[model samples]
Target: MLSFNTTIRKIHLWLGLTCGLIASFSGLTGSLYVWQPEITAALNPELLKVENVENIKEVTILKSVVSLIETHKDSLNKIFLPYREQQTIAIQFKNGKTNYYHPVTSEFLGEKSASISFFENLLNLHRTLGIPQIGKYIIGTSAIIFFIILITSGVYIWWKAYANNLKKGFKVKWKAKKKKFNFDLHKALGIYFFIPLIIIAFTGSYFTYNAVYKSALKVFDNPNTHLINQQKNKNFSTLNETLLNSNEKYALRAIYFPKDKSGMYRIRYIKDRFIKAGYRKTKEVEINEKGDITTLSDFRFDSNSNRIVAQFYPIHIGEIAGICGRILVFISGMVPLVLLITGFRIYRLKKNKGLKKK
Candidate 1:
């Protein structure tokens, strides 16, 4: 039988030696990402309008804010109406640069960005270094390598502890010598985070490698059936046309509109077909005042594996988890940093001890 970590060990060693810091940095930054709202709130409490406005319409508020912003708008092109869990009708827009405004009262909230964006920058650096094309590949490859290291180290550490039949594997032995202590932390925490870490790695790798998606089509014996497939309708239809034209088979839960050309208004819904085929979507449709869809000739949603793959990253990242899921992932992400610091400290102490004896 092949040894559990025979190959895993080599992979783990190389990744840890080469990219451990990057992995830890990525984890730390990722952990912070889930808490963005908290950071945003803390950074600028004024951004959140606490007044309860019952008569407020999301679109109305968005328009009010858009008009105010447009008065100063330069390169201020498209604006994404903010949709978060809490009360936020701020429309994110750009004007030679980027800014946001309150939809209510058409109040100019002034140009502001979250100090917490630093965390995003850190994460980008950890993930892609804020560059595209070349940067994307760099981060993608590193993420793949990082996944291997996480899996192998986790399995090896778990094995080393379990084979010894040690009852204290999960708990810290604070009184133990340094190296043993770090090993304990690393092993115990690795076991704790194995599943989540694995998920993050897998989802991350999925984003990095396009080949995996191609192979998926062949493996699943279906092309794009699992993905939420939406095609563009060359008919040049408007959003109103789509809304008036098609009768949807399912009740849409949410809708997203693309701000510019080539972008589509994607409506997301769960129908009976979704469970078997994953989620379905309307083809990239046009957008209008009522958020109407494009002409019936506009592309329709295809129940394909490709659409299913689209959901994986969001789901794994806890975006699909709703607020509670994000909290759990946030906690898990932070745990890795503790594990890294404590593990390294323990390792160093042990090394010094061995050197003294030598």
Candidate 2:
């Protein structure tokens, strides 16, 4: 019978082989996704950018939205507020089309289909492997296995191998024989990048198994009932009131128009310091036609569970620490591919040696 350490090694090896490709695909796609916003803007400059005009008043934005609603009517879905003067206001329609308008003039510049965009496809593949319902579960399960089983077992195998010679675990023996070099590369990279890999995997799993995380966190027992308010009203003018009434300290991020008579207007806000990479730090509010504003969710004032939940997106993509963090996350995504290659090489070499001995 194999010893406990040996059994763990076997488990780690097989699990790595089984889920290695999935993890690699996810990592590569995730790295690309880290720059999706920038890349999308670069690729569609005419649609994304506009003239850098002076102070765009709330009345101007309201007029633009009202004009858009008059033409588009009930098809309008959500309106994304421009982050800067040069950025165009994006209005997404129920028909899956996103039309960009001049922030100051409300002139239609261009439009794109959500289903056909390159990044949209890439995001779909990353999240669900381009498969529908079951794909997310598969990716989520793989992430869980990667996070829990493979990482822990791999660490144990490494510790068991290098407990006596700890220094060897940190460095790759580049001048050594092919098999030894491969082993060292695999072990060193795994040990060095394991923390990031674990974070990425955990966050990915958190998205897929959100209920599980929330349940584990004990946040579901008493949910925030005040997050959304449903009523029978559709007044486009309320958007202007929402804009005017909004806190001037917080920069408006986006405004989600109600879909039906029962829906309420939702507004998103971000602090000035976090304007660049503030995915998790945003504050959301919902307003009815009566101008009764309800605080939906704010990261700064959220419960511990809610705050942790909000941090998952930024942490997963490395937006938590801004550009430097994103760079680290991008590199971490690529490490899995390298580890997979070296691990396969080592496995093949060992198998070949065993065959020769036989």
Candidate 3:
């Protein structure tokens, strides 16, 4: 059998050629995604209008908001409660989504989703390539190809450099020729970035195929991080009323009432956000079938888990990295494209020289 090195190189070279454009496009979009907050702020500041709310308990406010939504006859798909320190509570329904009164009282601070307020098409382009089902496959394949290309180039370059006593690796003569310069930059940058690119590739792959990571995390029996459907309680009205009675300090991220006696009412809280930031807090509050708040015993902020599970996707996509982290991703993402360009120039020069000799 041919060695693993030979096989992977072939895969990398062919895949790189086939998918380089897709990879470049995906990377470009990804680079933009990291700066979405800044872009949104610049483009539509009014959408993320600022305001203050003083005298509202999270639970009662949440119930009243839900009731309001019900009166509007909106089909509830998801409910988001408000947390302390954040300005707005959100309720997402299937038919026509609605935003409750912003904590901004006394001033008619209006609300909007895709237009004046809370939506951007650019974001959809970043994640889904602005293409949808077809785009996902393209991006997913690009991610895998990116890794394959890196490894192939890395192995060939490293092996070639070290094979000749490792002494020839450092001296790319500047008195130099264009070929020498091109090859040197290609090799130099590749070495500097092999690790970061690999991390990006693997993490990205997690989104394309989640089963692998899910299984890996399962080895330690720690897969219980996600929540399942809740049991329904007989007294939905009473439970809802009781929860409204409790005091909550954080913005809600998720909310669901169970279907049966053994079920629990689950609510998630996150710091006010339409923008990603460094110092953020998240937690979940659980009101059990017995009207017991099992999360942190008293305040919901102290609840151990995120009211919802934000798995590997965001971190993989570099969204978790606030701002500076995104800039790093932008730099690293552009490297492969640079390599592609320089590598071709060198390859063309070498090919012409070989013909001249013949």
Best by lDDT: 2
Model 1: lDDT equals: 0.56
> Per-residue lDDT of 1-358 in model 1, one digit per residue for the tens?
6586656655554556456665676677777777666666667656654455445644454345446544744343444343332244343343334455565666656555646357657667656767877776766776676666666665775677587775666677878986776677777777777778777766766766766764675554444343332323343254433433445554222334355556555544333211122222333334544433443221134334445565665555576666666776777777656765765665567679899999
The regions of model 1 sitting more than 4 angstroms off are 1-11, 53-55, 58-75, 85-95, 114-123, 131-133, 164-168, 214-304, 342-358
Residue-wise lDDT of candidate 3 within 23-89, one digit each (tens)? 6666666666665555554553443334333455455456655565445442555555443222454
Error of 3 at 108 (Å): 6.2
Best by TM-score: 2
TM-score ranking from best candidate downward: 2, 1, 3
Q: Which lDDT tens digits does candidate 2 get at residues 1-358?
A: 9988788889889989989879989999999888776777677778776554346665566567667767877787887767632276788888867888887777888777452288878988999998888999889999999989988888888898899998978988789998788888899989998899999999999878998897687644346544332322233346565565444446677777787888887878766422255555667778876666777767655656676888798899898788899899999999888888998898898899999999
Candidate 2 or 1, higher TM-score: 2
Segments of candidate 2 deviating more than 4 angstroms:
51-63, 83-86, 113-116, 218-239, 272-279, 288-292
- Residue 235 error for model 3, in Å? 8.3
Better of 2 and 3 by TM-score: 2
The 10 consecutive residues of candidate 2 with the worst lDDT sum are 227-236
